[model samples]
Target: MPLNASLPRRDAPFKLGATALLLVDMQRIWLEPGLDPDHADWGPDHYFYRQTREVAIPNQQALLRAARASGVEVLHTIIQSLTEDGRDRSLDHKLTPIHIPPSLEAGLPPKRLAPVGDEILLPKTSSGVFNSTNLDYLLKNLSIEHLVVAGILTDQCVDMTVRDGADRGYLVTCVADACAAPTPERHSGALKAFGGYCWVAEAAEVVARFEALGRDAAA
Candidate 1:
């Protein structure tokens, strides 16, 4: 089957608040060949997965453009320990197994706390956003009420961020098309689980929403 053919297409118009599009852990290490999922002992069907080798990039690019045009805030989060000496990881970081393909121990470059200027990018050590990062403070200070999410590891970072955002009373939407993982099953499963805490929308739905908001603002 054509990889993305099974995905839903969305084109709805909705208003956007002072929303932020949070990009979670879409690092090169996660997408590039240097990080090999096959090494994880998964079968050929399970190895390297399809999302990175196929979909995701286009959806993310579209979301990025729409976010910039609509002037919605963009936030990024990455999982990286504080120091090479392991001081930043806390006991939790050390205790966590480093068997994952793109984990800190997998030689994935520790999240650099991207110097994004006005855009907020929080550095985290764990899967959950609020569990380790000051993202709560950043959101409250920005006075943001809505969150639009995109990034890699839909079953992990993206999933955790949306869950936390919703728990804290933010309007959370996950760009289902923009997130990547090793396989479609894992990606879809995460979307289903996070649906309780998020509105799982396609990239098109978010873009249309942003554009509609712009039109309403001008009208």
Candidate 2:
């Protein structure tokens, strides 16, 4: 994905009071090449690095800035096991053919940019953030009913989280450019699969809509 300068202006501002931004799996394990020294080495040929650098990070940064300026609560969703022994991880992580670790110390940490302000970090042991964390509780407490989602591994964690958010009745807007997958095909497929459940847009468009909301409030 490239930087989209043509941002769409909403006809009217959305209910900004009920909106929040959820950034999922934007951690070092996925974003940084050598964060996990023990993991398989990735070179310039790695699709993950190229997509993240060329597409996701920049878009995510734009969304974060816009959300902060618009006063939309910003939250991060990360995958982490509750126990060192991986007992709290999902069956897929515990089983073969898909063994995922539950610790960030070795493979995870926010990579491109650090969380500032009072942004809350929600940890989960499963693909869906809501399934393993108190994300629902936090959203309810904050009265957040609309969510703008962006992050890495668009085909996995982000997809699952979006589905969960939709099922819980939140109006979701997925920033396509701010998300990445192992391949372009997988990324596009994931977005298409969940397109019906959420309003998908580029980061620039989402940022424009958010800023438009601010303008409406000022007016």
Candidate 3:
């Protein structure tokens, strides 16, 4: 069968990577609202990306707990303009104006350097992690195979990372309950679209897998 952008294989359970969690885009800016037609439902406090702030936040946190217990590396890829001139952001970000420059220009907001201590916060100008970042080198050095992805804007960042991971010879497991689009409909839609591309599992399932693995590893 031909590869469908909207379909993923339903046969195998995802093979875990070196056990790395590739978290994308949790900047205060991406969390902001826009009035663009594409973001008609987006507004400050409108709950457009509510699943992220509400559902995914807690779920991802629980996954993080499992990750730590399992000794999995956690990395964050946040989208931001590298320059005030906005040379990095695509026309989509530029036109959509999801965030004004300087705010997302890598200095201000909460996208500060790699979550302060152990977390590696990566800022990307593009959608895919391997597009220009050292993510490839980093993952390779760590011998990463399957990437457990969780983050905001499901159809965009989550989709891209899953696609790129598959292309780069890594298995991808996307925590569906721990993900969210700009809206609920799109969030669910992205899950359906990630069908053939990613092994979509609930956050609780991911945690359960890790816990079970931990017990097995100990035994």
Candidate 4:
């Protein structure tokens, strides 16, 4: 028997109603500068900032529009602690020295990617939203089996979420062009590293797939 014999086909079509668009850690902290001036090295000239502002953000906007139009559930996750003092962060985060004050706007998504209507936003303290939040339970409750992911720091939060989601049995797809990392090499390497765990495609392909699903449902 093949290793994937028991798993759903990797190329299976997405069912719009059962699919969801999960934007991971797209908050102002990562997308915008000046939020963490201490790390001034991550300025506008940095590869991470450049890739996110020039490539990822615009592509994610396209995905967001298609998701809304196709009625795909949209969810956002941001790295945040439950308490202002940062007592609620995961051990990994604490050790990593990654701290985001609960009261700061750093946890909020950028204006262009803000949630609309009944869309949801989940706050997490760990790299993997599935590990620190009620995301898995919420997905189950919403009957979401297919998760389309897009976000920043492709080598960190996005990579963790994609791998974890796949192991938990969700049909996961990572939008390559809609995610960025500390550097171009890290971004591409993370995608290639996790390529076997989930479907990896560009933003345009994902939007097309979502649109196709909508058409099929309407037929």
Candidate 5:
């Protein structure tokens, strides 16, 4: 498909069992305030944190609730190194200096947004989960064909996941309000830049779709 081609929505009926809600990099390192005191500018007062705390987290919660109620599989990914010395990270991560020590609390998601029951939490050292993790195989095993993505850094991991997931033949939908970047410009720019790669919608719209799917299933 052309990069500028209009995105085509999946025509098949929405099936909860075949859809997964993937939360990307929603861990404490990004969500928690004051975790990076060294860079106080990037702390709670930053636009990223403000957006996350005021918008993304709440919207993601709604998405999570709807996904769970509709029986859509839920998965989360965090930027965590597999090795104690951080040697297992992808080359891109190493160069970008994005390393999260597994031993630290920063690797864990916030309590309210954390996975429950059998939901999967994948620790990845790369921005693209598909590039560093067995997520593709896992999704295949779960028979997932549609991926609903929400999480931090709209321009980075979330963007990469949408593009990669689309290229892998999965129908991907990005929850715009459930994602944030360092600035509003970057956040909106990413959506526009990758708009053709996947269906981009607000959390409320995605939740409504899930609810409608539930209603359809009941009928």
Candidate 6:
């Protein structure tokens, strides 16, 4: 596939070197079962579970693989309680405290598809990664002007991050298929809300964009 201007080309808005893939809450804790001891309260039955399991996870894996192969930095983010007692969580969390186990068995990606040694791991206790973590500083330090955003809960963390990133001057590409919400309506609504704020794209198209860039470089 040839690189085209109609597509969200990293070079047109910002150099490829200034771009990165920001994967938010791709954790098994939220996408899989048995990780959280409190699964009875919020488990596979959750409305977003199937979408995250069947759609977001696989697409996220592909995007991460492609981003790494193309030499684009891959950054992961997780929303977890800072303390076992849930004392450090945000006010929203305070109102709705979460009781997840302190285990990495499902908190991170599978070992076979885990982030490479060079990938950055960012932890946050809020819906947005930028404000909760040092994401802004890190992006600025690395000169990242564009962000390819994907992950679970399209209407929450992913949505908040996209808006924040855009506000901070980063060209954001929201991977539609690589994000989910409690329902189809919520997922669609979130993307619709972000319609004017970012370049909303499908996972396949995003993958093709990266592959096209690779081909262009080879030529």
Question: Using TM-score as the measure, which candidate wins?
Answer: 4
Q: Write the per-residue lDDT of candidate 3 for residues 1-219, one digit (tens) a residue.
A: 656765535324433446678777766555546523445566666655565566877787788778767667788887666676786787777776543354544333343213435867676777777785888888889887767898877888788888888788777888888777766788888888876777888888888877765666667
Using all chains and alpha carbons, the TM-scores for the candidates as numbered come to 0.77, 0.85, 0.77, 0.93, 0.91, 0.83
lDDT of 2 by residue, 1-219 (tens): 546555433222357678888989777765667764544677756987898888788888888888788888889877666666777678876663232366445345454456777889876777889888999999999998788899977889889988999899787888899999878999999999998778888888889878876776677
RMSD of each: 8.4, 6.7, 5.3, 1.8, 3.2, 5.0
Residue lDDT tens for model 1, 1-219: 799786433222333556777878765445555465534454334433456444566676677677767777777776666665556664665686322223355333233323245776566678887888888888788777778888778888788888888789777888888887776788889898888787788888788888767676667
Off by over 4 Å in 4: 1-7
lDDT of 5 by residue, 87-110 (tens): 998888788777788898877999
Candidate 6 TM-score, true structure as reference: 0.83
Error (Å) of candidate 2 at residue 156 is 0.9
In candidate 1, stretches whose alpha carbon ends up further than 4 angstroms from where it belongs are 1-17, 36-50, 97-117
Question: How well does candidate 1 match the true structure, expressed as C-alpha RMSD?
Answer: 8.4
lDDT of 6 by residue, 62-127 (tens): 887777766677888887666677677778767766543345466666553467887898868788
Q: lDDT of each structure?
A: 0.69, 0.78, 0.70, 0.88, 0.87, 0.78
Using alpha carbons, what is the TM-score of model 4? 0.93
Provide the lowest-lDDT 10-residue window in model 1. 106-115
Residue 21 accuracy (lDDT) in model 5: 94
- Tell me, by lDDT, which candidate is best: 4
Candidate 2, position 211, lDDT: 87
- Following a full C-alpha superposition, what root-mean-square deviation does model 6 have from the true structure? 5.0
**Cα deviation in Å at residue 193, candidate 6?**
1.3
Model 6 scores what on Cα lDDT?
0.78
Clashes of each: 0, 0, 7, 0, 0, 0
